[model samples]
Target chain A: MEKLQEINNKAALNASGALSKLIDRPVKMNITMADVRKVEELSPVIGPEEIVAGVYLPVTGEITGAALLIFPKESSFNLSDLLVRREPGTTRKLTGLDKSALKELGNIVCGSYLTVFSNALQVKIIGHVPSFSFDMFGAIVSQIITEFVQKSEKALVVEIEIIFELKALKGYFLLLFELPQFNAILRSLDSV
Target chain B: MMENIEVNMGDLVVTKNQDKLTTSAVGSCLVITLYDLKFKIGALAHTMLTDRRVSHLKRDALDATSSSARTREGGNERRHEIRDMKYVDAAIDEMIKKMVTQGANKENLEAKLVGGANMFPALKSDIGKENVLAAKKKLKEEGIRLVGESVGGSQGRSVEFSVASGIVTVKIKF
Candidate 1:
């Protein structure tokens, strides 16, 4: 019984260590209102409601993980218009081309945020191709959370709202860490 | 003598000779080809979306609706002048009309379907499923029989229709 307890204790410690290595220490990022302002400067007429931003850090201590940053349609469309330089009314609908542009924007935003993880975890993180879809803000957030969070044992969801002028673009970022990879990180840390 | 003709999306092609009509990268899209051995007439259509209320020509214009509406309106004249057309419904319709014009009885027409694949797994929306369902439903309503089909999967498919033998050979991603 004592031996079994010791083995269990070691397993728990290794698991915790992996989580620590996969994600930043605090779990939540300290993104200020000013950061939102800076992001808005890249576009025009950001949102009429407060924009939400979030980050998901994998807790599995894996060297590679997935990160997702979602933006509301209003903010997305505004940013797309700015990036593509289409005059207002000329392109009121978000067509396939507009969706592609938005995905590119998401790629950039997520890429920048991943740098923070790289510095914190001291591991290389590469991203897959980003995809974009338009829907109600709450629906998108809930769906992402439901699909990525509810399925995992323990997950962290970081949320923030960005307000610019009368417009607000809500954001949600989800991070998923591979369990096996995280275990390896913890084992390596123990050896060190 | 086998003629290899490329069928672009939203376009339809038909031939009675032993020509091969082929299209690449079919996703959430249906390729409907009809062959009448009696008249040696073959027709193929590549459609991205499914809708019964609209014609293939109208839908193709709508697919490119991002352009100015005026351009679309004015382009109609040029579109009409072109004999080759695209759109699943319109293509099928046009093919039927042409086959009849070329001595193919409407009652004798038979179709072989292929190439509806779900290329992007992450996309929760199943466009390929919808396309297949739409094609089946429309064909049934129009009194056309689907003799055989190769539908939904994760990989893209290349489809080829041989007019001479009415054989459709679908090659999965090499």
Candidate 2:
């Protein structure tokens, strides 16, 4: 537990730094290690049926899982405005360019965390190209969970808080690992 | 008074009173509801997968007969096998059983299907489609008429089923 906390803290710092540089604003990220839940019991990060923007990045190598970044409907619109450099509150709908920008954000933030994890565990980890979706929170989350449930029944929930330009938004980063892969991660970290 | 009940993933609920069964944020998952008007009994299931027979973990476990072998092959794999209700085929059968146990006549039961949406269009996943197909197939095999449906597409939906009226309300955001 302590080791995971340390790794999580480091990853959050690195991710925030990368995001801050990309957006050209001071971004603060706080990660709270939430509970390890049964895969079926993996609750929605936001309102289950609330429409939100989601970026899914699949991870492979030492472990197989995914990292999902979610922004509530309002936050997504606001973030899109900032990313596309439009007037504040001006992005009522996302264009192709806006979608690309959000996918890049997923890559940078999720990539940074994976980098730290690979270094700490000495495992080869890769985050694949991101896919973007604007849909119900329950739908997006459950789809991702379904992909991983065949291999693993436990999911780790990480509550993420992102603050920038005096505004704060809530996000969730979930990690799902197959039992064997999970055990391997633990064993590798224990040896270090 | 109409009571509301929330059905989570891999769960099913049956009631005969003036109650509403609801499940929200259904993406690729399928929500199956069975209603018997005469008895005023309704059952709802929030199922995530199509068939357990094709599950990799299940296949591996089946290949290994002994409990010791299953555990030795994968850490805690034996204990983590998903419940049968998580699959559409099994969930439908189970839901019907539950409705019957709650004083519903099998002949009067009609089914409604909701959800089965592909939330991420870029990803090549047919789980949602397969889940819908499986449910339809299972319902037919069981001789249950499918009265209504709101499935497919890339939009997520919320579903509410009222036993008293046998009405299913499906909603999507934009």
Candidate 3:
């Protein structure tokens, strides 16, 4: 477990590097130890039914699971504007170009995020193109919980907070790995 | 005290009187609500997949769905397992039974459906649409009158169902 935690931290750091390259700016992202909290604690980070924009990517290989980038609805607009070089607050509604931009960005970050695991475990893994959505945070997270990963009593997840110091932007990244493959992932991490 | 009982993803609970039943962020997932007007009791289920028969799915999910898959070809040692509300069929059945145990009349129960958004656009099959169809078919099978629904968009929804008023309020967040 300790080894896997170390790997998780490294993957998170790799994600930060990838994201910085994507945005061409410095972003401070913190990775925390993962656990599913009680609903009281869960509601605020995700919001009590707050609307959000999420980009979901499937990670498939020996150690399979998924990852997602979630943003508060307003944050999505701002992020899209920043990515496309539009004036801040210029994107009131997400256009086709915006959605495409978000998907491409998610794919790149997730691809890089999973690359760390693939390298550590010596496995060949691929990240699917992310599917983007604007929805309620709980609904989206629940879907991933129920449909995407193997059922464990709780989720093996890593929470990432991405902060743009100058822009005052806040966003989140959540990675959920296959519950049944915990030992498989750990063993792979140990191989190095 | 009128408490707000939360129904988790792929789970359900029954509440009575001033108490309300609530679930959040139902996207591509379905929230089915049952109300017994006379008893002021409410039940809600947050369901993800439509059925268990599909082979391509790779979730290590709970409920009878996965268990049945696990026991498909085993020798006849099957007895009724504990009920789980993760699947749509079992959830509705259990919700109805729970409502009955709490003084609800099957004849007087009304139903409302919420959630079921197509969160995954790149995927060809629409799980949200499939969930809606499955729920509608099951409701028809159970003879439950479908009062209302907010489904099949690219958004998430939060629902609060009050049995006291038989009113289910839905807030869509996009």
Candidate 4:
């Protein structure tokens, strides 16, 4: 709850404006707010064997937690060659319609960051059914922080970086709750 | 002794001489290293599952499904000296009882399994082969001595355990 970093940077720019209207392009998102360091001070931002292409969502009701969406295997085969239209590296080996178009583009960028965390923290969060891991960004974030960092050493990260066209894709949008569902989303952000 | 010791993701770390425990990528997640080569010690774990008593991180609903747990209730002494390492049977029983209370003998233990791969072959029972059969049944029921393994397939690996030259330098990534 480090002051919810400006409501997690406006919920990562409304999840990068819903991924620039469904990947039409020009999607740039940047929001880094980790006020809980200690899982070895995070650091190694994707390297433990690289690979990457994870998206383990779990944002259930009234703000529960978990939402990771990493991508680095050449930014997920260059965004799965523009999410399936194909060309560049021709979806380089990600088979089957480019792994279901990168899990349908990680289910529309994690359902637009859980609909901007349920309408900018109003509540009712939900992002279920998201389970995709291309693996090894240290074993998919070591299975995305096993048991939510054992009940919180303080984790509410939200570092998303998704620049498009010119090509750039980074990840991490973890938000494992505890501490009364993060003070119940900081008291429902004071009635939004 | 900070010679480059970094074991995040469920975490684990232990050292002795020239330290060097590293952990990266290792998809499906699993990197259990316990050297103790006559007290050069070692101990490195990076589990993501293979046992936390089979699923328990209970977040409520990931809708996709509520998630599993990683148990992080700390009081520090290095969190009870490297607690749970996020399961692989409670991180090789808490790094073999902290490497025999830091004297490390237990018959000169020596195991080195790294990154159980299987990235994502459409998921169905292959949490990297159940974290490589729970790290070879807890290193053969604690009789230790598994020697070495790079495990499964589907790329991504980046290990580096030295602990005074016991040597483990994997770097796959394909």
Query: What is each predicted model's overall lDDT from 0 to 1?
Result: 0.53, 0.80, 0.72, 0.67
Runs with alpha carbons beyond 4 Å of true place in candidate 4: A1-50, A54-66, A70-75, A83-108, A111-113, A124-138, A143-148, A151-176, A179-192, B1-44, B47-167
Cα misplacement distance, residue A78 of candidate 4 (Å): 7.4
lDDT of 4 at A157: 58
Estimated TM-score for each candidate: 0.44, 0.84, 0.81, 0.35
True contacts kept of each: 0.00, 0.83, 0.85, 0.58
Instruction: Please compute DockQ, using alpha carbons, for every candidate against the native two-chain complex.
Output: 0.02, 0.49, 0.60, 0.27
Chain B TM-score, candidate 1? 0.79
The TM-score leader among the candidates is 2
DockQ (0 to 1) for model 3: 0.60
Q: Which whole-number lDDT from 0 to 100 does residue A92 have in model 1?
A: 52
Model 4 chain B is weakest, by summed lDDT over 10 consecutive residues, at B59-68
Which residue runs of candidate 3 sit more than 4 Å off their true CA positions?
A1-44, A89-92, A150-165, B53-82
Chain A TM-score per candidate?
Answer: 0.49, 0.86, 0.75, 0.32
Give per-residue CA lDDT, model 4, range A1-192, as digits (tens): 434666567666776776677667667777654454443345466545556677676666765667666677777887777766677666666776676667766767667656766776666877777667665565555544543444234455566667777765766655566445766665765555
Give per-residue lDDT, candidate 3, residue B47: 80
Clashing residue pairs, backbone N/CA/C < 3 A, model 3: A136-B156, A139-B25, A151-B60, B28-B117
TM-score of model 3 relative to the true fold? 0.81
Residue-level error in angstroms, candidate 4, position A182: 9.1
Which of 2 and 4 is ahead in lDDT?
A: 2
